[model samples]
Target: MVIAVVADIVGSRKLDDRTSAQRILDETIARVEADLPLAQQPLTPTVGDEQQGVYRALDDALVSLLMIQLRLPDGIAFRFGIGIGAVSAVESVHGELADGPGWYAARAAIDTVHAKEGRAVPGARTWIVGAPGQDEVMPSTIAASNAYLLVRDELVGAMSERERRLTYGRLIGRSQQELAADEGISQPSVSKSLRSAGSAALLDGVAALRGDSA
Candidate 1:
């Protein structure tokens, strides 16, 4: 099976003030390219704020999306539309292709994500578009999205001030030691609270939200 991914940076206009958005676009594309399992898979060009690429496996494509979402810089987010189907043709290095069910499915997925206001995660946050005979894939994506949203809501609803600090710190890539120093807490303490709040487990839940199994 072939899977196509289209990812766009949210709020591109705001980011334009910083560095013309080229650096961020390049960074996002590079990040996805590096994460692809198959070294031979071609990385397509970016059109303005959007980037597109293809993979031979649905699992690999899904993993690439998750990796990009997790690694994006703060104040910057992404919306992804994934379509899985058969490919009739792939134009060499460019990844351009003739219209087919796969292309239609991808367009549907993009519409779904846009309808959700670019929230491409589990629960109500992300929307998934699927094609015919995709029974196994669709349900899993939906279930995972739901589970992730549940965890996110729970954490945000109940976390204390200190807990919130540590959680955001980790989510935004701060090391436990750094968060500890900033918060005047021990590294162990930071880890403990994070674990107790199920932050790491929650991340696992979100990652699990993708794939053919929920």
Candidate 2:
């Protein structure tokens, strides 16, 4: 089984320069994939505002998606829905099309995010769902993942643009001195921002997801 992802810009119509935003989104996706190298299919723009991709594991999806969230510039944000199941490709006149339970679960997961955003957790940007008829164990995994995602989205949504950048730099093994140099700030300031913005905790969480030691 593969992990399928569906993503769309958070506020596409409100952007003053949609073309520039799309360019940044594309570039950021490329950069993250180059760094992480986990996606079975790198995220690519699909229809209208949505993008699609697949990963071999749930941890890979979580890591790459979080990096995308952090790497994006200030004005652009994406909401993601991840699905766990099987995918089949159908030959089509327009090339090949992704069909099956995996894509359907991804669609349902995104719809869940949309509904949650409108009700209480407006910061909710990601959700996960498993295909129907999965083994009993899968539901528990999905529940745990959704719990983690809720907190992850809230913390990321609250971070300043600079905080996000700093977090992303740290994730890719960039030193504080290097990040400070790039940001035109001091190393101490970079440290302060990471601590104050809860980036340290977020990074720890990411490490745990990746099966790395704390």
Candidate 3:
């Protein structure tokens, strides 16, 4: 099974300097692709302000989504759609041309997120799609994933810039001590930031999402 991820900037068209958003997005894509074990087809830009990529594992995709979400500047939020299905086409020579059931589902997922955003759903960011009717396990998993994403996105969005940096560092496995040094704050202050921002709860959500929670 292949997992397809489709992502777009939330307000690219409104940006006074559109290129800045694109540059940041490109850098984010590069960072994610380099860090994750992607499928043979790496992330490639699509029409407008969107990009798509394939991942071998759902957890990897989730990590990439959170990383990108936190890294984007305040004006450039992201919406992600993850699809789990078959990839009928993948072009090594032209990664952007890849298409299949997975791609279509990812497309649908993004549209769903966009619709939710229009309805003023708070932190409607990450979404997933799969063939639903016949697949019991997959549907249940998707539901749980959505539940986790709802809280995760909202918590991240609510964080201050300092809190966000601390949370991102934590997500990437940086110790609180290291984060304190990075931020020029005491270790106790780092713990306080994590507590106040609900970063610890976010980590618990991530653990649940990745099936690591007991």
Candidate 4:
């Protein structure tokens, strides 16, 4: 089964510059895909502030979405819902429309994220759901992934922008010295920032997703 991802801007109606925010989103997706190249169909604007994409695997979606989160600038953010199942396209007057249980599950997942934010977990940004009756995913796996995402989203939401940039740099294999030079700080300071901000743990998570030995 393929993984379908649905994402929409966070607080889009309140943004001062919607056009610029869209541009940043587009550019960020381009950069992350260039570095990671995971999406089977790279995220493309669907309508309004929403975007959609497909991935061949769940790990790819998690890793790419996490990179996008870290790469985005302040004042702009996205929430993602990933659904696993079958997807199809049906011809429509306007164009070929995506229609299937995969998209339906994705919509449900995004709704879950929205509902979650109003509750105790305000930092919630990503979630996953498996289409009912789909043999591709098990309920236990989805539950565990959601548990991981809850904590992951909280840690990422708490990071300062600088910490995010450094984390992204490390994810893409930039050395601490290189990151420090870019930020105009000492290498030791860069290392400290990464450690203190929990970038190492995030990096380790991504590495684990990639099946790299710890």
Candidate 5:
């Protein structure tokens, strides 16, 4: 089956510069495996705040995103992007990972998400290289697109424009210092805004939008 791949960070630069980000990443991976075992997927942790994984079905993938949004701890949030395509091999040799048009498509999706402007939220953006028979086989893609629309609105309602811009800056690989410079503010001011804006409430709003109890 053609599947969608998602990569994300549980906390952006808001995490301490030290080892806490890695611990958070590990915790995020464990949560994914525990919460959605049926997806039967593996996630590769990249850098301190990022992780990559694949899903065999769009519904499972979207559900996983929702779960991540709902479960993140206070002072932590996530920004993610997804790609959809077909792969010849679901699981490959230990050292030789899956790499093909599907993998490339997935990377493209991540790139698209990374290119987005402000904080990354569910359905911030996605890339899809239609696999053979993909249009006919994956009706859920349409549903997922609709779901993303809802997610976007929910995120916007939960966060202000300033918050979104800061989040977007981080997603595009801008460091906290860089974002501060770009906004003509000190790094501490940026940090203060993010904390004062209430990350937990934003996440709760996201969960509510997904029809989950916050």
Candidate 6:
């Protein structure tokens, strides 16, 4: 199955100057592409601060988003919509232009993220929509995925800048000692940052998102 990931800068219009945020988003997206290795098309900027990408696997798409979330500056954020299905048309030579149910579902998914859901928090920044299950399988799967994304967003949103850096390093498999050296801090401090931010849980959640567990 093909997975489509579409994302846009959060609060893009609120910034007095959007240039810096755009730069960060572009850099982060490019880093995600290099780290995650998109199968068909790399995540490409579509509009001012929006991007779309296609991956050969769901794991790659989810992991890429997780990486982006962790590495972003405190002032930067994006919402993601992930869709899974067959790729019916490749408009460009490199899968940059795609037209299919996957893209449609992905567009629908991001639309849901922007809409209010009852009394639920409005910033459910990541969501997924899968093609028809031939049964009722699609709804339940999407529900489970969004539930995780909601909690993950809240957790990341609550972190301090230092905590975010530590979490990001930890997510990418960096050792605490190495991270401490990079930050010019003692290992204990790095460990404390990760522990205080509940890094273990965050890392596990990301791993689970990639379907690495169960």
Best lDDT among the predictions, by candidate number? 2
Instruction: Count the clashes in each prediction.
Output: 5, 0, 0, 0, 5, 0
Q: Ranking by lDDT, best first? A: 2, 4, 3, 6, 1, 5
Q: Report lDDT (Cα) of residue 14, candidate 1.
A: 80
Off by over 4 Å in 3: 33-42, 90-96, 132-134, 210-214
Task: Identify the superior model by lDDT, candidate 2 or candidate 3.
Answer: 2
State how far residue 22 of model 6 sits from its true place (Å).
2.0
Lowest lDDT 10-mer window, candidate 6?
115-124
My TM-score estimates for the predictions, one after another, are: 0.61, 0.98, 0.87, 0.98, 0.55, 0.85
Residue 6 miss distance in model 1 (angstroms): 1.4
Could you report the Cα RMSD, in angstroms, for every candidate shown?
Answer: 6.1, 0.8, 2.7, 1.0, 10.9, 3.0
Where model 2 places Cα greater than 4 Å from the true spot, the runs are: none
Scored against the true structure, residue 127 in model 3 reaches a CA lDDT of 91
The Cα local distance difference test for each model comes to 0.59, 0.94, 0.79, 0.93, 0.56, 0.78
lDDT of 6 at 16: 69
- Model 6, CA-based lDDT: 0.78
Q: Candidate 4 has which clashing residue pairs, if any? A: none
Per-residue CA lDDT of model 3 for 1-214, tens digit only, reads 6789888878777889888778878887677566544444556677888887888777768766787777666777779988988877656865636677888889899999889878878578989998433266788878888887877888888888888778878876789999999889999999999999998887776676567789
Q: Give a tens-digit lDDT track for model 5, residues 1-214.
A: 6564656553365666536755765676576667455354656665455566777765556555645544445455555455566665556565445655656666665665555534554435444444445566465755566455455536544665566556544433357798799889999988876666554444444445446653
Q: After best superposition, candidate 1 residue 205: deviation in angstroms?
A: 3.6
Error of 3 at 58 (Å): 2.2
Candidates in descending TM-score order = 2, 4, 3, 6, 1, 5
lDDT tens per residue, model 6, 56-147? 87666766777788888887788888888766666676654567888888888888788733347665788898876423775776678678
Residue 108, candidate 3: alpha-carbon lDDT: 91
Q: 188, model 2: CA deviation in Å?
A: 0.9
